[model samples]
Target chain A: MWELIRANKRNSIVLMVIMASVLLVLGFVIGMVFFGQEGGFFGLMIATTIWLVLTLISFSSGDQILLSASRAQPITHEVHPQLFNVVEEMKIAAGLPAMPKIYIINDPAPNAFATGRNPQNASVAVTAGLLARLNRDELQGVIAHEISHIVHRDILFVTLAGIMLGSIVLLSQVFLRGMFYSSMGGSRRRYSSGGKGGGQAQIVMLVIAIIAAILAPIMAQLLYFALSRRREYLADAGAARLTRYPEGLASALEKIAGDPSPQLATVNKVTAPMYIVNPFKKAKQIKLSNLTSTHPPISERIKILRNLSQGASFNEYSDAYANVTHKKTIVPVAALSTKEDVPLRQASAEAGSEERLDKQMRQVGDIIRRVNQFIFLTCACGLKLKIPPNYKSNKINCPRCNKSLDIPRK
Target chain B: MGTSILIVFLILVGIPLLLILFVIGIYNALVRLRNQVDNAWSQIDVQLKRRHDLIPNLVETAKGYMKHERGTFEAITQARSQAMGAKTVSEAAKAEGALGEALSKFMLVVENYPDLKANQNFLAVQEELTGTENKIAFARQSYNDQVLFFNNKIQMFPSNIIAGMFGFTKRDFFEIEVAAEREVPKVSFS
Candidate 1:
């Protein structure tokens, strides 16, 4: 595991350096286009400053931003004891230093994500529908996958890389839009006002700058997607190893992918990659776009997970991945070298009857209502009333018995 | 003469210093692994304590509807006490396995009492008991994993020499001794 983290850290640094250089070069060329040769250094300085500021913001409160963006409410252990216990179990299994704070999104989509700068400060957020749908073993599988992301330090890497990609995209968009609106003839005339030789060089620089602005974001995105896809595989392997049950994750992935619910309401392109399953309904249907996706195909991920037959070790996951994908191993060699024979454990006994499903659904609804400050009133006629916090009336008559009841005060 | 003296000094002091530093590095790593093993063991202890605390509530809840099942109650109580009194990892492992077996038997007998199954208190206790059991199992799994890593480090090459010098020893795994644990519970449908 340490080897995996170290390798991830190294690769992240290399990718960041490549991204930083791309940002700087793009800035330099754009600067040259706008202010002739002298503006190159000025543009480089601006790019560096922008990168630093964005990095600062993400490192300090990126998790908070993401949690709020998803409309996730902080949940105590009482809101869902089983969920807390499962997260605790995964924390032990992964040997994380502290428990990641738990949150519940109001959305009905069955998806989850982990976010923090590091494991110690991490938080795991799951949608309300996930809690209502998955059984204990399946829930553990999902939490274990998110915990694995925290353990592997993937959150930090993805945050840094995502910021870089955002900066590059933002810069290119601004430059392209500015070029579109402004006249190209003005820049050409402005360059010719300098000197003939310098004017020709400036024109060449402007063309190169336009081309760089066009291609830089694409190249950066491809790099980011390549690394992110590999990290997903590694996190999957880590999840299997941590939970010691590959089938749980496999089934959970299938359920989440096969869910017919609408896409998560708050999910945008920036936060889409953070989810366990791609939140975009369109990504799964298009095979060609899968290459540029931050995550590997759901079917491929599920297949790799199901192929882990022998045990839940890095080596086993690597073998299963190779068998399923017919590709090179994603797990680091050092991680695979640890010959810990982690035998898979039996699934926790759970009854998945229809009655149990209804009960689970009710429990999840109650939990969400509780978080939303809903007041519960039980009538003498056996009717349960759920009053929203914003209810204007102090008393309400039961629909069943027409008996007025005062709302319980906190 | 001066150059030769410098060469002699380099060979004598530089090499031994490097060796000591190397030994120190290995020793520190071994110590870290040892501490991790100790930490993992404490995690198991915590889950075991939780299991012990929940068993009485479980028995108390079941005692109401299971009037004729005195033997199952006594078996669970006895196993719980034994597990609590256990002094070492292997001892705790054996005691906990016995407790687990007794609890499973009690649950099987619970099937005969529909009233007890329907009681909300019993159901809550059962949920907590099962969650604690899963936690204990996961904790034990990780404990054993840490023990394996520590034991391997103390027994494997290069580090073994440092381990010997520092008196590092192998730790026992929390193994399940009850043969019944490995057996699948029979589900009979009449």
Candidate 2:
């Protein structure tokens, strides 16, 4: 895992450098177009300053921005006891420093993701849809996957990389729009017809600027997407080892992927890769450069998980991954957590099938309801008042009886 | 000529620097492995202590309904104290196994009292105890796994070189010896 972290760190640093250079180059062309040749150096300096400042800010609080962006609310032990127990269990299994703060997205898209700089500061966010969809074992599998991301330090690199990627995307979008509006305003003629020495050179620079604006974001995204489909599989392997039940995760993958819901309400291009399954309901096989995709196919991941033979230990996971992916030893030798792999848990007997499903869904609903903070207050007039968790009023008037009820702080 | 001279100087300085870094990295890695073993052992220790703490609650919960199960309760308490007193890994394992045996027996006896099963507090405590037991089992497995990794690191080629130079020795596994535990058939069919 240390080795994987080091490699991911290297990958992120390389990607950042590439992005900054792309920005500098684009700035130079745009500068030349606007202010002639002398502005090239000035533009590079400005770009460098922006990159440095943004990188620092993103490094410090990228996770917070992501959580807020998803409209996630912080969850506690009191909100969902079973969820806390599972997270605690996985933390113990992985030997993490601190339990990752759990968050819940109100959207019903059935996806989960992890983000932070490291295990000590990490947080896991899941859609309320996930709680309602998955069973206990499946939830364990998914949480274990998120924990693996934290353990491998994938969250740090991915979050930081995500920041740079977002910046490039914004820069491209704004630049393209500016160019589009300028051409519409007859600025193409302005460059060719006047402006003294800016005539021919300015046209050339504008054309280059247009190309850079068009291509830079795509290049940045390709870089982000190329960041080891291996890492996702590695996390899958880690989840399997943590849970000792690959079928748990395999079934979860099927459910999350096969759900016919629309995209998550809050997910955008930048935050999409952070999720276990893409929150965007896109086709699984959108191969961009023919070599990699944003994540390995969900089916491929589930197959690799289901292929575990001896048990869910790291070595067995490696074998299964190699067999399914046909890639040898993507996991580092020193980082290989080769333990005695216990066999997958036997399936529970086929009794109380309907009751069990009901029980599971009710448990999920109850957990979601608790997390959502619906305070139960039954009035003297037999009126049940449902108060939101975020309600801050000290007193409430019961509609039925006109009796005042004191609301205590949760 | 100047560039060639600089290249020669670079090689002279760089080779030894790289060698030193490699040695340092190996030594540091070995140190990390040792620390991980210790960390894994503490995980087991924590879970075992949690199991110990929950035993009394279970006993107390069952006390009201299970009036005639005095001998079973006594055995459980005895095992718990013995486990608490255990100092070494082997001692802890043996003592914990005995405690597990006593607890399971007590559970079986409590089955005769239908009301105890229905008691919400007893049920919660019972569930919690079982959860702790599973955690302890996994923690023990993972600790032994850590020990195996540590041992392998020492026994391997390059890391073995560092281990020998640093006086790192193999540690013992927490071996449990009991009838029920012994019957858990080997999982690796291959």
**Best candidate, TM-score:** 1
Model 1's C-alpha root-mean-square deviation from the true structure amounts to: 2.4
**Model 2 C-alpha lDDT per residue in residues B126-149, reported as the tens digit of each score:** 757756766676676667767877
Q: Model 1: runs farther than 4 Å from truth? A: A184-189, A283-287, A392-397, A402-406, B1-12, B65-68, B112-121, B185-190
How many clashing residue pairs appear in each of the predictions shown? Answer: 0, 0
- Cα-based lDDT for every prediction: 0.87, 0.78
Interface RMSDs of all predictions? Answer: 1.1, 1.9
lDDT of 1 by residue, A1-410 (tens): 77888898888899999999999999998888787788999888887888899999999998898899899999988778888989998998888889999999988889999999988999999999999889988999999999999998988887888888899988888888888766655655676588889878977987898999999999998888888888888888989998889889889998898888888999876677788888888655576565678788889999998888788889999999899889888888878777878788777666678988898888899999988988988899989899999998889999999999998777
lDDT of 2 by residue, A174-236 (tens): 777877888788776666666667686777887888888888878887877767466787788
Clashing pairs in 2: none
DockQ values for all predictions? 0.69, 0.37
State the lDDT at A272 in candidate 2: 74
Q: What is the interface RMSD of candidate 1, in Å?
A: 1.1
User: Candidate 1 residues B96-152, lDDT tens each?
Assistant: 999999987888788899888877678778878877888888888888889998998
